[model samples]
Target chain A: MEQSKKLSAGILRNDRLMADGRTIRYYDTSGQNRSAKDARPVEKQPAIGELRLDPLVNEWIAMASHRQGRIFLPPKELCPLCPTTGELLTEIPESDFEVVVFDNRSPSLRPPTGDWALPDQVGPDTDLGSAAGKCEVICFTAEHGNAFKDLTPARVRVLLEAWIDRTAELSQESFIEHIAPFENRGEEIGVTLTHPHGQIYAYSYIPPRVEKMLAAANKYKTSTGKVLFDEVVAREIRDEERIIARNDRWIAFVPYAARYPFEIHVAPLNPVADLTGLTDQDRDAFAPIALEVMKRLDGVFGIDMAYIAAWHQAPVRVGRDVLRLHWQITSVRRAPGKLKYLAGSESAMGAFIMDMRPEQSAAQLREVVL
Target chain B: MEQSKKLSAGILRNDRLMADGRTIRYYDTSGQNRSAKDARPVEKQPAIGELRLDPLVNEWIAMASHRQGRIFLPPKELCPLCPTTGELLTEIPESDFEVVVFDNRSPSLRPPTGDWALPDQVGPDTDLGSAAGKCEVICFTAEHGNAFKDLTPARVRVLLEAWIDRTAELSQESFIEHIAPFENRGEEIGVTLTHPHGQIYAYSYIPPRVEKMLAAANKYKTSTGKVLFDEVVAREIRDEERIIARNDRWIAFVPYAARYPFEIHVAPLNPVADLTGLTDQDRDAFAPIALEVMKRLDGVFGIDMAYIAAWHQAPVRVGRDVLRLHWQITSVRRAPGKLKYLAGSESAMGAFIMDMRPEQSAAQLREVVL
Candidate 1:
C-alpha cells in the first residue's frame, strides 16, 4: 500500500508509511492558495440573503432579508426548492412524485451543460467534478413543508433507501471519495429551499476532518489492538450520562464537549462504512430514534427548533469500511437564543466552555416521552 | 516553581513531555482526563454539555445541549438579561457605568468558611482556589440597551481602562493565571442576562488552551528564532487576505481557519502581559477599527448580527505573558442561517472547512466604509 503524502511531499515508505507516500502538502502561510478562487457578486435577492464566512470559526453564515426573518419567525407556508424549470411551478404538488434526479433548472446557477450530468470538478467559476454528479430533490410530499419529524417510520425508511441508493450510485465515480446527504428544516433553522429535502455531495477528496479521523482510528487500532469506537460506544453505554435514547441496534448520545446545545449523535451498535452493508432492517431500526430526538427538541423548546441533520459515513476510499457511520444532529438553542456563544475558548483557542452538564440535559431529554 | 502534577495523576501525559516539566494532560483516550475524580459532577448548573478530551489533537469539546436549536434569535423588545435585582431597567445598558468590583452577593457554590479560605494541602474538590476567585460585570453602560458595537471610541476607552484596572488588581491573587473578559451580543451568540456588560473570569489555572498556545508560540519562536506573533502578524499584514482593518498601532484580520463567520482578530504591534502597557493614545486609535468591524458585520448581514467579543490575555499568575492577547469577534451566520451547519468536519473532526474565502471577505469588509 502506498503511504499517502498529503500534509507534506517527498517522504514515502512501505507498510508503516500511512499518508507518507503522498506528500503532506503544507499550505504556504501566504495567501497564494486562495488566489485562484473567484466569486460572483451576484445581485442580492431581497427574498434571500448574502452569505459570508466567519473567519475565526470558518463556518458560512447567511444574512437573509428582513422578509426572510419574517418567514423564519412565522412557520413555513412555502416550499422554495419546489419550482422546477420549464413550465414548472414554484409550488410543488401536494402529492408524491417519482424518484427523479435532474439539474436544478429554476436557477441563476446550475452547471450549464448540454447533458444531464455532474461536472468533473464542482465550484463557483469552474465546473469541475466537472459534472454535478447527481443533483436531485427528494420531496416526501409536493405540499408546503415538514421535517423528517413529520414523516412516518415507513416513509423515512423509504428516504433511507433513497439515500443508500444515491450513495451507491454516486460512489461509482472513482473521483468521488465521500458522498454527504443532509437536511435542513423549519424557519428558525433557515430553510429557504423548504421542499423538505436532503442533498448529496460527491466530494473529490476525503474532507480534511474525515481524513484526520481515519488517521486517529488507525492509530487507536494499532495501539489498543482493537477498535477505538468499540471501546467508546461500550464506555458510553456503561456511563449513560450523555445517552439520550438508545434501542437494540442504535444509540443516540450527547457527545462530550458538544459545540452546540442539543447536539445528538446516533450510531449503530457496531461500526459501518458503506451503505451496501446496511440491511433493509437497518433503515427500519434507525429512522425512529432520529424522529424521537427531533420530537424531543421541539417539545422541550416549545417553538420550532432549528437543527442540522448530518449523516457522516465512511469515505468510499480504501479504509473507511472499518470506521463508524453516524448522524450528528445539532440544534442551536444555547439558552433561548441569547447565550449560545462560541467564544474565544472554542473559536480561537479550541476550548469549549459550556454552561450546561450532559447528565442534566439527558435527564430532561429522556424525560420527554415524545 | 512547582510543576503542574497533572501528569503524575490518573491522567496520561498527552504528547511527549517537555524537559521544562510541562506536559499536556489527556483526561482519557479522547484527550479527556476523566477518572473517579472528575467523574463526580461538580454539582453545578444542570450540566448542559460535556467536555470531551481529544488526546491526539489535544483539544476539548463541549457536548451538552447538542440538539437544541435557534441560539441567537432574540426577543423583540424584552431583553432577558434585564436586571431583576434593582434600578437596572436594561440588562444591556445604553449609557456608561463606573467600574465597580465587589464580592458577589450571591452565595458561593464552593462555600468558603475559615480554613478553606486559608490555602494549604487540600483535596481537588476542596481546593479553595476555585472558591476565592470572583466574577464581575463591567457595566459598559448605565442605560438599558446597546452592545460593544454601539460604544463610542471614548466609551470603549473607558471599558478598556476598566479591563486594565481589573487585570492588575486580580493578578495579585497568586492563584489567578488568566483574566478572561468577554462580551456576548445578540441573543444567538449566548448572552445570558443580556446586559451591555462583559464578564471577567479570573481562573486559578491557565485553562488548557492558553497553556497550549504558550507552547506553540514558544516552539514557533524556537524554530524560527523570532517572535512568532510578530512574524505571523507581519505576514498577515502582507497577505492582506484575512486583514479586516489596519490602524496605526494595531492590525485586525480574520483568521485563516476561522471557527466562525466574519471572525476578527485584533493584534497589537507591541506585545504586553496586560492592557496597562497600552497608552490611551493607542487604545483610542484601535477603538474605531473595532467599532468599524462590528458596523461592517451589521451592514454585511443588514441585521444586528450576534457575536462573541472575547479577550485572550496572558494568564495573570504565570508572569510570562505569551504576547498574543487579542479579541476574537465571531458571529454565527454560516450562510444566512439556512446553511449554517457545523458539519462533521468542525464538530467530530477538528478540521475546519470554510466555504467562503478570506480574501473575498476582506475585500467585502474593506468596501464597507465604516
Candidate 2:
C-alpha cells in the first residue's frame, strides 16, 4: 500500500489493496489511518466485460454476464456496504469511515490490460473489444438506513471533495475518455442496495449523450461565437418560469425542453468544464441547493421518488472548452404509484413524450415548503 | 363519411367521424359496414401538443399535458378498445370487428393544420412548434382477453394488412417524414389499456434512433456498395447461433450486440423497404414466425413476459433503399420476477449493459417448446 496523501479541502486519501487484488480508497476528513486488513476469503477474479459496437446505432454495448449473480436487495443485517462489525465482515474492512470508494467486484468495466484501439468500422462478426476502463462504488455514509437527503451540508461537501479527487485520479489512465459519477436512488429504479451509495464509471469511449452535447456545443460555438451552456443558464434566468432554486454561485432549474416530468439541472453560474475546476466557494454554495432540490422532490409527491442523479462533465482529453459541467436529476415518478416507463417510443425510437409541461412541474416544485 | 373502399387482400376500409370531429378508420376482412356513430359526449377539442427541440441533444420532445388524464388500467368490463355493447360506448363504435384503427382520444401528435416548418436552429427561447402529425390506435382483436400470441395465423395476417395499409396511407401526408408502428405490452411497460392493441405514430421528423440507423446505413452503403440491413440478415443466417426462428421469407435472430436481456429482431430475407413492399407470400410466412417468437418468449419463463414490439421501417421519403423493414422486440424481464431497469448508465448516458450474452439468450429461446 502507498502512503496516505492529502487532497484539496483537507481530505486525507488512503489507498489499500483488497484480498482479491482490487484497490480501495478511503477519503476521510479527520485524517485517520485506514490500514485494517480484509478478513474475507480471496476468490478468482472474474473476466472483464466485452464492448461490442452496435452497427445499427453506432454505439457501444457492454456485456457483463458475470454480474447476473451480484448481490440484490439484501436485508439490513446482511448489507455488504456497511462498515465491518465484530460479528460480520463486509466489503469495508474498517470499523468506521467518513467516505469510501472501491473497485466493483462485478464491474461492467475493468482496468485496461493492453492497448485499447478499436476498429473504424464494425460488422456483425467483428471481434469484441475489452471494456478496458473502471467501475467504482462510492459509499456516502456508513449508516445503513440513511439517505442522501439526510446528510448534512458539511457531509455533502465531503462527498463532493471525494468526487473531485476520484475524477482527477481516474483521468490519469491512458484508456479513459469519459467519467460518469451518478446515483440511482429508490428501489423503483432497480437499486439493489438499500444503503445510500453512488457509482463512478470510467469509459474507454465517450458516451452517446455526452457526444451529442459536445457536438451541439461545438456547432453553437462555431455559429454564434458563444458557449451554449452559458446561453442556456442565462435564458433560464431571464425567463424565470422554470427556475426552482438559486444561490449566488449556482442555479437549479427545470429545462424548457425537459424530457422527464420532474427534471432539474444544477449548473454553476460561471463556466466550469468539470468538477475538478470548481472553486472552494463554488462547492460550498452547491451543497445547500442540492439538498433543497432533493427535499422538494420528495415533498411534491410525499414519497421517496425514484431518480437518477447524473453529472455531465467534459471528456477527459477533449471538449473541455465547449462542454460544461451540470448535475441533471430526473425522476421516473410521474404521479403517486405510477412510474414513467420508457416504452416503445422512448426506448426503441429515442423519442420522448412528457406527460406535463415543464412550467407546471417547476411551479409544483417551487410551491413545496422545504 | 367516405365510402367503404376495397383495399388489398380482400379487406374493406371504412372511414367515419366521431363526435369530437376525429377520424376513425376500420379495417375489416368480412367487408362489413362500420358507420356506427360515436355516442359519447362531444367536448371541446383539446390543444395540440407542442414540440420543443432539446438543444443539448437536438431532438424534439413532445409535450402533451393533455395525456395525463388518459384512461389507465380500466377494468375488463370497461376496456375502451373492446367492441361497443348495448350499455357501454367504447372507442370502437361497432358490435364486432376483425381489426380497427382509430384516432387516439389524447394524442401526442395531431393532423397538421397548415404549413408545418421547423426552424433550422433552436435556442432556449425558441417558440415551440405544433406536434403536426398523427397518432392512431390499432386494435388487433375485439376479444378483450385474447393476446397476440393466442391469435390465429389468419387473424395475424389481417393485422399485418392493416399495418401495411396504414403505413402507405400515412406517407401521403406532406408533414410526415417517418411512420412507426409499435405495441407496448403488459402493465410493466405502462400499457394503460388491457386490450391487445398497438399504436402508429406519424412523425413530422425522423426520430433519433432511426436517424442514427440511417446514417450508419448510408455510410455502409457508400463504403461497401451493399445494403446494411441485407448484410445484417445474411450474417445472422451464416452464424446460425442467434437464429431463434426462421422461414422462407423471414428470420428472427438475436443481434450480436443486444441491449436488452431478451431482444429479437425479425427481418425479411429479401430487400423490403417498408411493410407496403412485402409480397403476399412474404406476409404469409411472417405471421407464423412472429407468433412462434412471441410464444417462445412467453414459454421461457412460463409467464407472459412484458415487452415492447417496435416495427422499424424505412422513412416515408428518405432512406428507402438503405433502411429495410424489421421488427425489434425487447423485454425488460431478466428473470421470473426480476426486471432490468434503465438506471444511471442506460437512462442518462445512453449506454447499455446487458446481463447475459446474446448466444445464451438465443439458446434459451430456442430450447423453449412452443
Candidate 3:
C-alpha cells in the first residue's frame, strides 16, 4: 500500500492506501508517529453503479443497488469506523487518530477509470452515464459516542482545515463539477452509523438545487450588478428578526422562506466561492459559530436535533463568481415524536408547505439558552 | 347554508355550505337522498398563510404556522372524514356517500378574496404574496377502516370522476395555475388521518417538479417533433421489463430512472393534458388499472405499502399540449421496518441515490402474487 505524509495549517496529514486499494487519510493537530498497515484480507468491492438521467426532470439518479447490503446501526464491538484492535480489524488501521477520511466502502460514485467518463449532457437516446465521481467519509473524531457539538473548537478547526484540503484536492479532478460536504446525523435521519462522521460527494454534474441557486444568482447578478449572496446576507442583517446567532466571520439565521420546520443558514460575512477560497483566519473563526448554532438547534425541543448539515459551495467548473459558500442545516423533526415527511406535495411536486413560520422558528431558536 | 343538487355521468352530486361557510360536495353512485347539513358549531377559521418566494431557488414556500395545532391521528370515534351520525357530526354531512370533497378546515392555500391575488411573477423586490388557491379533502369511502385498494372498481370510478369535476371547476378560477390531486396513504407517510382520503391542491403557480417536467417536454418536442409523454409510454412498452401492469387506456410502469426504491408511473395510452380531457370510456378503464397497480404495490412486501400517489395534471394556463396527465406513486419504504430517508445528497442537493434498480423493482412488483 502506498503511503505519504505532509503538514499543512498546523495539521499533520498521513495518506495511505487500504488493502482493498481504497485511499485513507488521517489528520492530527499534534504530530504523532503514524505508521499503520491494513493487514486484513482484501475484500471484494461492490460493483460501481451507473447514473441514469431522467429526461422528464433533467436530473441524474445514481442506481447503487449494491448499497442495500451496507452496514446498518451495527453494535459498537463490530463498528467498522472504530480504530482497529489486535483481534478486531476495522476500516481504520491506526490505533488512534484525531480525524480521518477514507473512500466509502459502498459508494454511490467512484472515480472514473478506463474509458468511464461522465457525459456532459444526456438526451432521450443518451440517458445513462458512469456514476464517476468520488465519495469519502470524514470521521470527526475516533470517539464513538461523542457528537459534533461535544467537540472542542480546536478540533473543529482541524476538521474544517481537513475539509479545505480535501476540497482543494478533489477539485483537481476534471470530471468532478461540484463538491458537497455534508453530515446526516442521528438515527432519525437514517444514519446507518452511530459514529461521528460526515460525507463529501464529488458530483460529475451540478446538482439540481445548486443549479437552481446558480441560475438565480446569475439572474440577480445580471439584473442588479450585485452578488446574490451578499444581498441575501445584507437583507438578513437588516431584518434582524430571523438572525439567531452571528460572529465576526459568520452569521446564522433562519431563512426568510424556510422549507423545513427547523432550518438555519450559516453564511460567511466575507464572500468565498468555495471552501478552498477560505482564509486560515476564516476557517478558524467558523468553528465556534458552527458549534454555537448546533448547540442552539439541539437546545430547541430539548432533544439531540437530527439534522442534515450541508455545505453549499460553488461548482468547480462554473458559477464560481455568482454562487457563494454557505452551510444549510435542516431538521425533519417538527415536534417531539413527530416528523415532517415529504408527502404527496413535497415528494411528487417539489412544493413545500412549511408548518412553522420563519420568524417564530427564529425566535424559538434564539430563546434557547446556550 | 346554500344547497344545490345535480347529476353528472350517472352519478348524483350535491353541494352544500358548512356552518363555517366552506363548500362540501358529495358524489353518490346509488341514488340516495343526500340532504344532511353540517350543523356543528361554526369554528373560527385559521389565519391564511402567505406564500414567500425563495429567490435562491426560484420557488414559493407556504408558511402555515397555524397548522401546528391541526389534528394528528385522532381516534376512530373522532375520525373527521367519516359520515356524520345523528350524535356526532364530522366533515361529511351525509350518512353515506361514495365520494365526498370538502374545503380543508386548515388550508395551506385559500381562494383569493377582494384585493388579494397571486402575482404573475415574483422578484427580489416582491417576494411575498397571498397563498391564494383552493385546498380540498376527498374522502374515498364512508367506511373508516377501508383503504383505497379495498374500494370497489365502481367506487374508484366515481372518485376519478369527482377529481375530473373538481379539476374543471378549479380551472375556472383565474388565480389557480395548476391543480393536483394526490393521496398520501399510510401512517408512515405522515398521514394525520387514518380515514381513506386524498387531497386536491389548486396552486397559484406551477409546482417545481411539474415545471421541470414541462420544460423537458417542451425541449423534447422542439428537438424530436413528437410528444415526450407519448415517447416515454412507447419506450416503456418497447422495454417490457419495467412494465408491471397495463390496460388498453393506461400503462403502469416503473420509470427508466426511478428515484425511489418502489415507484410506478401510470400514464394514459392517449395524450390527455388534464383529468377533464379523459373520455367516459377512459375514466371507466382507469379504475381497474389503478386498482391493479395499487394492489401489486401492496403485494410487494405483503404489507400495506405506504405511498404518495400524485396525479400530475397540466397547468391551467399553460403546457396544455406538451404536458400529459400521469400518476406518479412513490413509496419511501425500502423494506419491511426500514425506510429510505432523503439524506444529505437528496434533501440538500436534490441528487437522488437509489438503493434499488428500477428494472429490478419492477420485476419484484411483477412477481408479487395478487
Indicate which candidate wins on DockQ: 2
Stretch of 10 with least lDDT, candidate 3 chain B: B117-126
Task: Return the candidate ranking by DockQ, descending.
Answer: 2, 3, 1
Q: Write the per-residue lDDT of candidate 3 for residues B273-362, one digit (tens) a residue.
A: 999998877898998989999899999899999999999988998989889999999999899988898999999999999999999999
* Candidate 2 interface RMSD, angstroms, 1 decimal: 1.0
User: lDDT tens digits, residues A1-370, model 2?
Assistant: 6458888778888998888878889988887889898889998888788998788878899999999888899998899999999987888999998889999999999887767766766765577988878999999999998988888898898899989988998999998989999999998889999899999999888998888888889988898888888888898899999999999999999999999999999999987999999998998888899999999999998988889999999999999998999999999889998888889889889999999899999999999998
Give Cα distance to truth, residue A183, candidate 2, Å: 0.2
Candidate 2: which pairs clash? none
Q: What is the TM-score of each candidate against the true structure?
A: 0.63, 0.99, 0.98
Clashing pairs in 3: none
Task: Assess the local accuracy of residue B215 in candidate 3 as a C-alpha lDDT between 0 and 100.
Answer: 89
In terms of TM-score, which candidate is strongest?
2
Give a tens-digit lDDT track for model 1, residues A29-91: 121221111121233422212233322222232232222122333234344434333443232
Q: Give me the runs in candidate 3 sitting further than 4 Å from their true place.
A: A1-8, A115-117, B1-8, B115-117, B125-127
List DockQ for all candidates: 0.16, 0.83, 0.82
